[model samples]
Target: MHKQFSDVDTVRAELLQNLVDDGETVTNLGSITRLEVVSRIEEVTKKIISSLSMEEAPVLTLKSRSRWSNVRFSKLVGLLLTMGGTVSTLRSDCPSTVMKFALILKALSAIYKLVQSDSYVTKRDIYYNDPQLFGSQKTLDTIVDDISCLLKVPRRSLHVCASTKGLISGDLCYLEEDGTRVDCTSTVVPVSSSVSGIINIVSSAKFVLVIEKDATFQRLVDDEFCINFYPCIIITGKGVPDVNSRLMVKKLWETLHIPVFALMDADPHGIEIMCIYKYGSISMAFEAPTLTVSSMLWLGLLPSDIESLGLPQDALIPLTVADERKLNNIKKRPYMSFHPAWEKEMELMLRWKQKAEIESLVSIAPHFLTRVYLHNKLSYGGWI
Candidate 1:
């Protein structure tokens, strides 16, 4: 492995050199191009088709890794993992395994067809492709996920897409590969899974602010947060993030080389979501190099702020048994241990036995979040 650089400027410069261009078949994200991916799919599909035509035993091979076995924590990169093993179709000897193998092939064929047509389809689209065979959306989603893991590529690279569950507002414009011109500064738009495939970006934003909830995002947008103060981008995962939002945030931070801060409820769930954005999720740990935003800071509704800012007592909620369990679970994770500030915050929350939402800020003042909280945090550099 090569030496990893902690310098943000140097990393950004290296990533920028790999951005895609017209007819460019190379990238630092993955040297593999769309056309190259298509060819690979065709080659795999042709081999299977020929085997069946010759009355030979049809064999398939998938190289994948298990999260439980493969994932590990890294101080610099968060959860990281490597893929290994070539699983053969011969493993499908059992009645149950046979059905599972068939499902995998069906998904592979669907992906191959998608590449052949030079188009893309969401997981929902794939689910509906063979509703009877695929059954529920989860079933199809799992199969597609398995394929990505097996092929050692992102779902996007395979043309299997997901819906946009995040919203964005900022001083940014970009051209999509399909010729869709997106001017984020014009209006709030959902950050689609297709964001990674965008042709180019033109932005003058100084930084990006990622809010945990859509309501908070809307509040910031309503207040013209960017227009009033700094020319910056504001984004929301709407809850837990979908891939597009995460990818877009990662892309912006890498390309623009700007500060990225997260605002969330002062609770375990919110902290987990924030961690996912900064350090890639455990399930997709292998993709951390491209997906995670290591520089993102926690700009928040901190546990200390509940008292420091004198928020209404009524706004605080007692932690449920479930919430406590979640916090305990998070505390056990390796990454959490590495961040003493985060550990201190979790300790504060556990001591209080209560959690508060960002919306609770309104109890102190209707415009408090945008006016007082965020302004003070950004101005005073109050982030961890």
Candidate 2:
């Protein structure tokens, strides 16, 4: 894609001019080493020490990630905290922020030990280590993210990880940090405990399928969906996904350069889950660079397919008040404008006020998902 410039900075600057155009997925700067992680931590600590001695208040400044004022929607990056979003300073002297400041330091200290030893621990593990000081898991989680953003490094880079919540099965194989070779071909494995340490990834899969619910994921496995299909990988985070699962999906897409697809039931929540895999959520948007998969295509169980498939209307569930409200919110999302096909499916769901689970298709025939529905979709290019 480089036509003229051979210099790295010049090429990067030229490419960045349109980096966020349309539906391009954002990528992180790359992995940081143990020494670099330690160095950054020391540097931040030194800055705070410098601030403590000076007229400065030893405050930690970071973007207000939770507030809507900090979030903006872009077709290129989904809903993310803008570079110029509202900033809040955590002051060491303020009574309100003193505990918060202590928590940040505590997290940093814990990170220093982890990086120094090249050890990995989950956020839950860190919380349990000093629950009294952390107060709760949420408190620990927040500070970890704050430290991550402040250090301009991913949480995983700090050696803090999420507890595994997703399962994967497919033609993929890889070696984890401890040099454990995992072959998902024979059995479904939990997503890597340390995604950053994974290496030697190999896969012959033509595509990846992200499932909404674990029950649905298991159902496919029982049907040998992985064996019979177009040699694809399947993953599920149960319902709402954790960071590791998102990271795995991003990694697979980047490495394989294969089409990624999402299959959710025809409902507002299902659509939202699909969006989370395709476009990063506003809550964790700061990590969008490493989490989102913009190429993820909407696969089966679409609302528009409900009538045309000739499925029984009697079994279909009518949308509840909450579902209608959620659907409206989904339609209004700024990224929705870039996806009229998705929007049309959503509009149809709202109009009919009916929803169906991916399981609902099973009534047509046993193993219909692998045997018929998904097969047709993948074979004939039926995905959106």
Candidate 3:
């Protein structure tokens, strides 16, 4: 638990205090339930309410780089990943700032209501709560994520719950905020806000396995992978992971002290998702210290394994134009050049111009993935 800010309560209270100190009334904030903004509200007052004086910029950092192969991996907890950044609203004339400045104040105001009511609102709720100002759900989401990064608090603590998008199962059980005891052993569990409150995780599992796709996750479940081979927890984000999924995995690793392995498609998007698990995403880089699982290793579906393992050639899909575009973007990323293994895989993919899905393992046999591929990969120590 690398908490950058004070506890959740303290942060929520401070947000409310800022609103009251700036003389913003409930009516001035507008209709939170109907997503309407009343006219004649002071935008200048909103900006003033949003900007806060800071003793220092955020003391968090991530694995970022400037040039090829120049990653600053040194764990400087108080330092930022990129060279320079805008922390406050005092400087910077970018047009983006004007909108973001207002959104931050709106978000803070929304959170204040949540704190006062002692309630939780989903991202969708907040989006619908103020569509006039938010414009789109994505805009609201980006602002909320930026707020979480800036405030140094988990989004859940800010009373924002992203629509849960991952599943979990295994020799594990936990309690939610409202005293709901969940037993994950016998069912596929949708991850709740396990990170926000007291999570009394009960598990005797050896390790946790995080799969990238829902199809592969279902395949493993159909094969009873966790029950037959090992006493372990299994999870999937279904695609690009959500915050709840990442947070659940981090909490499991920290609390259970078990090795966590990620299985993903042998493609740029897949690798990027896993990297977000191992290292925080560039957008949310500031929260890396609290969210990332640095020791999490890649399990399989590597590019070289496509040919080396002798899987059916028909199972491989040639890289599409869109896939190539994504690969090129990932290659240009500063952090990509630092890891030799990742760089090697990226090069191999570029050279071969092909990718494989975890489902490809099923070509060997229906249950080949869980029974053979993974078992052999683990037994032979074939993971990074």
Candidate 4:
């Protein structure tokens, strides 16, 4: 067995001292309790009722969360809601707004019951209650986020959770809300049930690796990568991470105070996904303080590595039209101005006219990623 990196604690701790996450301040991560959610629900309900009593069309002024115009970048907190940000109005009397306005109230009614009952439901389950009204799961997703932003509460606080889309493994143990003990040291598992309800997190891991793709994560599992590293936690959001995974990553960084590194493809989408984990997304900027881990370290296969490692010409994928467009947009992001290393790596990929996946490391050897490349990078300080 490849137990070359058998020592997890000492080496991991050493890395902790050497590796740093520049903008990781999760101490101020915000959470509201079930009682608070109920309180806010009651307050909002009363205002609507008061408007109805006065025969006035009830109007809701919500923070515009799904737009770039509403966000501001902060070196301290990453992307966040701008001060006195852009607002959108939803009026019950307006023909264009009435359907959505009704939908929001119905969803709120379900949420109120869930909080009071001390239970939670997935966004899918909520959507199913009246699918025709919601029109699509995407619409319900929007409504849930809109309500969260309007109330300035974590979406989980609304007694709603997204369908978990991430996976985890490696040296860590914790209790779920139902008192289910989860141990990730030996096997891969879903992130956790009701992540907000998890408690007593305990880990001896040296660092956390946020993987970009599930296929690569599964490859690591088959190679027993974590077993070799002993106490290193590895996770994947599958692709663009959902809220539960983001919260778990933020929580782990705050609690463990370990170095968090992102292992991703040398593609533009992969880079954007890592940025979402580190800098927060423009669509959900209002929740950046709790949802982002700005101190994220870049692990490989970086764009520069594709050339340096000499991956096969065929393995190097040509950038698609969409890829080029996304890369251009990524270069224009606010953080790009500060990260010249990122700029240099991107330029290399553009000049090469190719992108590479973590899977391409297989060309070097079947176990090159686990036995050679990763072992070397992780054992030593080989990350950006």
Best by TM-score: 4
* lDDT of candidate 2 over 311-368, digit per residue (tens): 8987699999999999998888778878899888988998998999998888788788
Regions more than 4 Å wrong, model 1: 1-28, 34-69, 83-90
Q: Which regions of candidate 2 deviate over 4 angstroms? A: 1-27, 55-57, 68-80
In model 3, what are the clashing residue pairs, if there are any?
Answer: none
Candidate 3 least-lDDT 10 residues = 31-40
- Decoy 1 TM-score against native: 0.85
Question: For every model shown, what is its TM-score relative to the native structure?
Answer: 0.85, 0.88, 0.76, 0.89
Q: How accurate is candidate 3 locally (lDDT)?
A: 0.69
Model 4's TM-score against the true structure: 0.89
Candidate 2, residue 17: how far the Cα is off, in Å = 5.3
Taking the tens digit of each residue's C-alpha lDDT, what string does model 4 give over 267-324? 9989999999988998788677767777787888789888788899988899988998
C-alpha lDDT of residue 165 in model 4: 81
TM-score, candidate number 3: 0.76
Give the per-residue lDDT digits (tens) of candidate 1, residues 79-139.
6553342343533456646777788888888888787786788899878767999779988
* lDDT for predicted candidate 2 compared with the true structure: 0.81
Residues 190-297, model 3: lDDT tens digits = 987555564788998877889999999888788788888878899998898888888888778767878888999999889888877876656665455456676677
* Window of ten residues with lowest summed lDDT in model 2: 1-10
User: What RMSD, rounded to one decimal, does every model reach?
Assistant: 5.6, 5.0, 9.9, 6.0
Model with the higher TM-score, candidate 3 or 4: 4
Ranking by TM-score: 4, 2, 1, 3
